[model samples]
Target: MSYLMMFYSAFFSTSVSASETAATANPMRSQVVADLVEFLIEAGQYLGMKLEQGSMSYQLFALGSIFLVAFASFILAKLILHFKVLRLVSRSNNTWDDCLMEAGVFRRIARIVPGIVVYTTYSLFFEPEDKLYSLLANFSAIYLLFTAWRTLSGSLTAIENIYSRSLLAKKAPITGFIQVTKLLLTLVLIFLLLSLLLGKSPIYLLSGLTAIAAVLLLIFRDTILGFVAGIQIAANRMFNTGDWIAMPKYEVDGEILEIGLNVVKVQNWDKTISTLPTYSLTTDAVKNWRGMTESGGRRIKRSVYLDIHSVSFADAELLEEWEGMKLLNQYLKDKKQELVEDRKLKEIEETDILNCRRLTNLGTFRAYLTSYLKKHEMINQDLTCMVRQLKPTEIGIPLEIYCFSKEKNWVAYEQIQADIFDHVLAILPVFKLRAYQRVSSHNEQAQKNAQ
Candidate 1:
């Protein structure tokens, strides 16, 4: 092995000068490699074997030596990466290095070591004009290219992970961009691989690609559309990871798990995963709730239908009873004074309840709800908050509460909403109101028989 090292070093030193010659088109066609093979054959003869230049014995020894050297180089590179590079990365305060480590960028780079070692030293084992030499060269080149691809892909992944931690990532993600770059990298790798395999220039092969451009387009139609959609989504500051988006067209209603080049993954509320094409996000109607999340409020728009038969004007008894309530006392007192003054000015009699400015139970209930919501701890007072009646339907008059909740979390918001409706339904009877309930066939028959 010591002699072998000396041979390699001396071979490289001489090959540098020999490579400058016009006749030396291939650097692997070295006189030093020829000398090394002759030395191996002589050594084999000294061992009392019937050895010759092209003998199986000499070739086996040479091939085994190449494997040993390539394996040693690979192990050395891996050890250096683990002890030196990884140690430094682990100690670094910056998170990006950790991301790179996790992405296996260093590991992928280490895999190139064996290919490089084999490429430089393989000529020593066989004559440059031998078929084995060409085969080894091709294999080494392909191995290098493949390892380079892995390294570059890992680098891109590390880049995306680093960018995801930035504040800008929440506004505009780069995952799609990273994926698009990977796709381009793959295409380039394929072109280079084809050129290498076919023994042609990359540019020559690329020129031929123009003839099959339509087929390529059809094959990569979604990929091409996704790239364009990704650009639009990023530039326009569209939805990002963790955003709750609803694309009914795709039956997707969930928080975005990932946004990639070709697809956007959403984890639906039912815990089912939905995958939508990236282009579909741009072309289809996707409702992004990022605005609500960023605004620190989640809108709540719901209706409580009150049985129309239960609604009536507030009588003197009802007003007096509501005056003792904390939420409605001041409101009732203020309205009473305003109404008394208005009636006196208009010369209207209090006996005429319709003409006189008296409060209805529905109106007073709306005011109470408004005041209650304004003071509720969980509701966002800064945003729109109101309670009003909707047009009476066959079933009932809908009292709609339109407001936003301070809690933006799904579970918390749901709990807050539930709490509000619970309070509304429980307190409705106090206003002499009843929630509309559909009559069952059994109850309808009983009612009809009683009537």
Candidate 2:
């Protein structure tokens, strides 16, 4: 306890001497604080306590006081911002202010208050020649720089939030660009921070770092590529969020969730997440279904095989039966009239069915399918709707139905396509045509036994 008292006496005496000198040399130093220190030292000495002047303890005390003042100032700033600034922001009807607050822009801005306080008042606690003063000044500058970085970063976040609500965001997402800007800002901050810590100019450090440019390139190869690719993507307006992209090479087929600086996130149809480097979007061959989506229709290109043996000329009875059908009524009338004119033009007799331009059952079936698609509610009539026959394969003749569906949704499109094919297959027997199917051994044996 006695040693502690002596230490206090010596510390106060040193503080008093240093404060007096500081007050005389620097007009900005607080005279009242210096007088308080002097009075404490004089009172302790008058009470028969041994005292000394100008000790290392005084410098330590001044440095400690500067840090203490900075801490207290930070708390006070927070209290003021919470009660005054934050309340005002919250009560306002502005959406921008709300975004800024939510992103902590104001909070991060308030962080500089302590650094400012320390910077402005450091001289009051230490002289111009004091090493502690230089140290505090450098520290406060770095602190302010960091606070500025945080505030700016938060502001960028707020900007992104504001942009996300706009209609254009869906078509032209700026996330990659924003991330690139943030990365550049972070690099600048790092350089500045390094300059301050090393007591060197940023230009000098940048020049020195040029020697390691190759090493830096190797380290940030992906980042550089992504940055370049991001620029290309934005400039070209290739794809955006919610666009369905298929990259078979990567086994990725999904909607884009996010386009970031390093990677793009995809939410697959199966609810699984896929991540690919942003550069890959530029380098890779990806199919964007946005055109199909924007066209408001999805194509259905599928073929149904038919037994070639079932293809025969339409006889009189079959022609009469198809003529009565409502869907084929007008079609048959036009065809019969055209056939009569054609047979007259070529001087061919109707009794000579082999030489006449008569319609085959396969051709009639194809015509019926075309008319059915034209009248179907789900098929888009404005687009190319066709039923064409392809070359015969070993299996059968390929009768392909190519059309766009009114319903572009996957499930709805599938249902529409299934309904069309179901109707076609069921009505095939009416035309006396068979959908070709490979006969299984069991069916062949059963047929033989039945015969």
Candidate 3:
């Protein structure tokens, strides 16, 4: 094989000068390959078989040489990169080289080197006008297209992996974008490949494709919608991996598991997996809890209905009982003094509870709630913290506790909220207040027991 390459090089060296002179006198056809085949046929005849030019022996030898050349070139390129270049790249301190390694960037690029060698060297082993030349050329082009596809795919993988480590990835994930790119590339490669195989122009094939437009649309309906939707979702930064989204229509109330081109996977809190169409995310309503998480607080907006009949004015006994409460001492003292001053100046009758100023249990309870929440460590004091009264319902007046919780974790926030309501409900009797309870069969039985 080494001697053949040397002879082959020497023959091409002489043929080039002869071809220049022959071009002026006659046609400079590649007879060098023909002469080489003759020499190989003579060599094969010396091995006891009668050989002839264009016979099975000569054809096998020519094909074998081409295969051997391609295989040898590919092995050499791969070994060099594997032993020296890629090994060194892997050991480098730079983060990008490591990313390339994981994406198989070097391996994909190396695989193309052999196809390129074969593409350029095929003319050397076979005559330019030979039947095999056209076949080899088409095969080489196909190889290049396939290898180029892999190279681009690996490069996209590297880009995605590198970008994912950045801070912006959390706000806007791009995995779906990368997948869409690969899908488009695949469609283009398929078009180019079919055109090459059928010996048709790409524009001709594209024109022919329009005839089947309805079929293609029906087949790729989901894929087309997903591709378009993936672009919008990624570009708009609507949702990302780990973002908690609540889509009631889809029964999805959990964080995103994976965002892909055709599907967006969500792992529900109930441990079930919900697969949503990528386009549906843009079409449907979704509640993104990302704002609450990023804002460092979760809203604790709950109401405890208070029985209107239990509300009463604070008399001497009730006022004394409220005075013993640590949180309401200052408030009660100020109100008492204010009432006394108003009585002395206005000359109003103190016996009339409605006309004159007097504290109500509901008002004192609201004050006590305000003071308790302000001192509570779990409540977000930086935002609105208040005990507001809503309109009276058929049940009772709703005393709503509108505030934000410092603990944002689901379980922790629930425990904190429950602890607050527990204390409030237990001490309501001391303030002559009672929570409204809806009538049930059990509740009617409990009323009978109380009677």
Candidate 4:
């Protein structure tokens, strides 16, 4: 292009001199000179010419140089990523890169070098106005953006893994928060790409969103609600991953498996999974077994019916007999002495049982139950342990045993409860008390035959 520049300079100088000295300078001469230079340059380009023709074969040398540079860059990046950086990362005990590997972070990052090579070399191969160069550059940019996105996603996943492995993360999970941040990052990247492609300011596009705020809210209502609820749950320590919770509204009676932005997953005892909206945990009433679990006890609240007819005041003979029984010996002795002293002090008639506070067989049974529970190895003595009688119904008097069992496991707790009831049922007759039962036809027939 230097030869053309020299020829144009001389031609333009001559034209200026002729215009100063002559009546008219020929515009056709200037036009002809310009056209001849343009033709020569075009002919040289078609013949694969260079400014210094003998210095190097332009196309061959330029193409080879571009290829070599691109190939070298690719090899260097590959070597750095695979043989050097990744190998070093793999050897380290730190789990951060291990998580990255698991999440495919390095693999995504490895694409960046090749993408840069293609982007740089494509421009060297074709002119700026060429469609092929533009297409290649655009594709390279897209690939680079995609790789960046993938790396970002994988890095976020790696961060989540790292957080989950931490002690604090186990106690207060940040999975939902991490996920929401990832989603926001993804959206921002998408907007940035659009802005880049449209050659418009991102701020301008964002400002346009003011009119669609309501639509955005509607679209992300659940996510927004769940994000708020997740924060509340974590900050308040309302629930944890392993907490056994029951939400009848959602049919979830199970241990919490995961809490996410939009949903909470539960794995039930029956091996069924139940998913509940994250906001439901904050807004709705759900039973958390955390209290019971933390207390190290499982409650046993059940009752056995006592036949009303079998309940009677214990006479001296019956009291003496109970005093000989090992389990009730000390209790009966103490009560009998108390009763005798009370009767003597009140000057009550000994034969008139209603005149004194005499212990009934049912009362003795209740006392026995309280003592039994207190002495039980499987019962939690630190809590409210009691044996009380509920109001009598037509069936009988409900003798309720309210206590906490040592075992929290369902099977073990049930066994312990059953064992206590079994002993109670078996020993009831020893106190001259009978458990209430519906009279059957066989018993009626036997009584009639006896009569």
What TM-score would every model get versus the actual structure?
0.86, 0.85, 0.84, 0.79
**Global lDDT of each candidate:** 0.83, 0.82, 0.82, 0.77
Q: What global local distance difference test value does model 4 have?
A: 0.77
**Residue 360 CA displacement from its true place in model 4, Å:** 1.0
Q: What ranges in model 4 sit over 4 Å off?
A: 1-91, 119-127, 438-451
- Index of the highest-TM-score prediction: 1
Candidate 1: C-alpha RMSD to true structure equals 6.2
TM-score of 4: 0.79
Global Cα lDDT for candidate 2: 0.82
What range of 10 consecutive residues in model 3 has the weakest lDDT sum?
8-17
- In TM-score terms, candidate 3 sits at 0.84
Tens digits of per-residue lDDT, candidate 1, 1-451, equal 3453344334323232343462276556566667777787777778787666766676677777787889998899999998999999988999999999999998999899998888887666765555666677778878987898999999999999899988888888888889888988888778767766777755567679789999989999998999899999899988789999998888899999998989999999999999989999889888998888889699999999988877788888888889899999889889989999999999999897778877888888999999999999999888899998899999789999999999988899999999999999999889998788887564587689999
What would the per-residue lDDT of candidate 4 be over residues 244-298, giving only the tens digit for each residue? 9998887889999999989999999999999989999999999999899899689
Task: State the lDDT of candidate 3 residue by residue for 1-451, as single tens digits.
Answer: 3453354233323223443464446433446545666676776777776766545565566667677778898899889988998889977988777888899988888889878877766655554455676677678878988998999999999988888877888878888789978987788788777867776656677779889999999988988898888788778888889999999999999989888888999999998999999898899999999899998678988999998878988889998888899999999889989998998888887887667888899999999998999999999899889999899999999998988999999999999999999988988998999899887574588689999
lDDT of 4 at 304: 95
Ranking 1 against 3 by lDDT, winner: 1
- Model 3: lDDT equals 0.82
- Those runs of model 2 whose alpha carbons end farther than 4 Å from true positions after fitting are 1-65, 128-131, 440-451
